[model samples]
Target: MTVKAEPFDLSGKVAMVTGAAGGLGQCFAKTLSAAGASVVLCSRDRDRPELVRLANDLAGAERLAMDVVSHASVEQAFEVLDEKGIQVDILVNNAGVAISGRAQALSDADWNAVVDTNLRGAWTVSQQLAKRLIEQSRPGSIVNIASILGLQPSKGTAPYAVSKAGLIQMTRALALEWARFNIRVNALSPGYIETDINREFLQSDTAAAHIKRIPTRRVGVAEDLAGPILLLASAAGEHMTGSNLVVDGGHSCASL
Candidate 1:
């Protein structure tokens, strides 16, 4: 007998994941697809081989070339979706960059790149989606991929941590303002997840010492955040908004 996925099922929903070419972004796209949502894998380059391959592996998936930092690019991406008659109800703002450096040493361009992509970019995407949802009187969910560093301090991650902190606050502020429209906004902050973005750092001596501060005594894998991602994306978390779900293996609570 065919069984229904009662709790985390996302059938009949459409999820768009940004930065789908990256490690955690890829994981989010795959996870949403596995839960029955028709996924749209987005990257700066739609024709990227990795993104194209990912789209081919999923059912009813589409590829979008979107640079979240550019308002024109974001607007164009949505326009393309509208042309295709695809209405996305689930959005994963997972496009982010980390430039490792101290605050004093980082260049203005580097700082702007990180902040523009992580904070302003997220705002643009959320606002775009919320406007359409409100127009159609439809409900939707937005999941922002944040980090433990947003809640605390991390060396050599000044820009990334600050950007994530802004995103977390943005999640709450948007949730409060958009709840009346039935739009739920939340953040998922992961701790030291092993991905291409930070695999080398997580495996390095500095990270090794830092890992001991986590109660779990180990770094997390992308799979570790799947449940939290689904909870914020699906009906299972209908009543949840303005919430930041930190999936950091107790790293946030740990003391030096």
Candidate 2:
């Protein structure tokens, strides 16, 4: 006999999405909210008009200021959540920065900046959230937004690749350590996605050449990640901790 599958429902869940002011972060917040979770749209600057507008527009959505690079900032954000009696049941660590430059010419500042935000930042936020879940004896989920570059190297993306690779490993380590507490940790590695910042470049001839290398022969959009993200964030993925789900339109399958 086959058992009925659980629904991918997040009703009554509270999800915190970092860097939700724009881009993929905003999309993540919107997706989670639509699935019935009360979303906390977090950005380094919560006072941005767009963020405020989004928070007000989405039912059961709120905005908070959080800088994942700073432990103090992460702590303060959680403290505010505590004051409001909001416990985080899901976390989307999507705040990241990419500094493209030749590895030989990369400055200490640039390398540090990328690593700090991409790796350290995720750690800071995840640690704080894990602590809260442990204290309350509740189960939770964490989805780290990684990249295809993490699995393979590319030109002028050394630091970014390194950071993402580290994050992937960190996901496994955290999942192993936190399993007893019922906190699942996983990584979501997305391929090249056309966003406001990269749209022009991605549409250029130079990008066209790169696109040919992809098996799918097309770049992904932010919405392409919605299903994978929601699966990892909800009960449907309860047994999926320590996995790195790659949604890159077959970019990683091509022979380099």
Candidate 3:
């Protein structure tokens, strides 16, 4: 009898993580590398030092410049990957932006920026990955990094929330349409993971009061999302397409 490899093991696989220069994207790339997948770190600038350092530190890792908000940039990046003969087996659509503003006060610029980066950008990237996978007749996984605010509305985050909500819906729709091709698409919605961009706010008095609203009584850290990402990226979640894995420390549950 032969022993099967662990379902979570990603040995010999390739994972492309967008927005991988820093924050949660960094953690996701590192985690996938640890699970034995060759990671492709993609960001607005491929030459970013942190991305280069990470690629150097990890085995079988490469860094690429890809701006999710720019279709031409995304296309060019994929063309380069094709030239390099790198077929991504797992795609993490983790590139997103959040602009805080009430619906009434939000400028068109603010709304468009958030919506374009968070929703339209994710769709563009996912579509590119899925198209390549289908053309190659390869099965793959796609993990969309979403937010609890997508499920539970919050004040002063209208544009961000709407974008994430659209993202969750996009994940479901893509999963439904691509299941026939054996491609899994899912959303991993985080509650409030602390990242460099939000560090100041997380330490502020306003955040202190807000923390109590969560059942866990604390906002999560970037490391908190490692498990959910792995589950979705590997064979462990092969049967979980179209599902939304909430990693919000029960925050979304309270609203439900």
- The lowest-lDDT stretch of 10 consecutive residues in candidate 1 is 1-10
Query: What lDDT does each candidate get?
Result: 0.91, 0.91, 0.90
- List runs of model 1 lying over 4 Å from the truth: 1-5
TM-score of predicted structure 2: 0.96
Q: How many backbone clashes does candidate 2 have?
A: 0
Candidate 1 colliding pairs: none
In model 2, residue pairs whose N, Cα or C atoms come closer than 3 Å (at least 3 residues apart or on different chains), thus clashing, are: none
lDDT of 2 by residue, 25-120 (tens): 888888889888999999999998879988987898889999988889999999999999999999999999888878999999999999999999
Model 3 misplacement above 4 A: 1-4
Give the distance in Å from residue 121's predicted Cα in candidate 3 to where it truly belongs: 0.8
Query: What CA RMSD would you report for each candidate?
Result: 2.7, 1.5, 1.7
lDDT of 3 by residue, 74-167 (tens): 9999999999999999999998877886689889999989899899999998889889999999999999998988997777889988999999
TM-score against native, each model: 0.96, 0.96, 0.96
Give me the displacement of residue 15 in model 1, in angstroms.
Answer: 0.3
Tell me the deviation in Å of residue 38 in model 1: 0.3
lDDT pick, better of 2 and 3: 2
From the highest lDDT down, the ranking of the candidates is 2, 1, 3
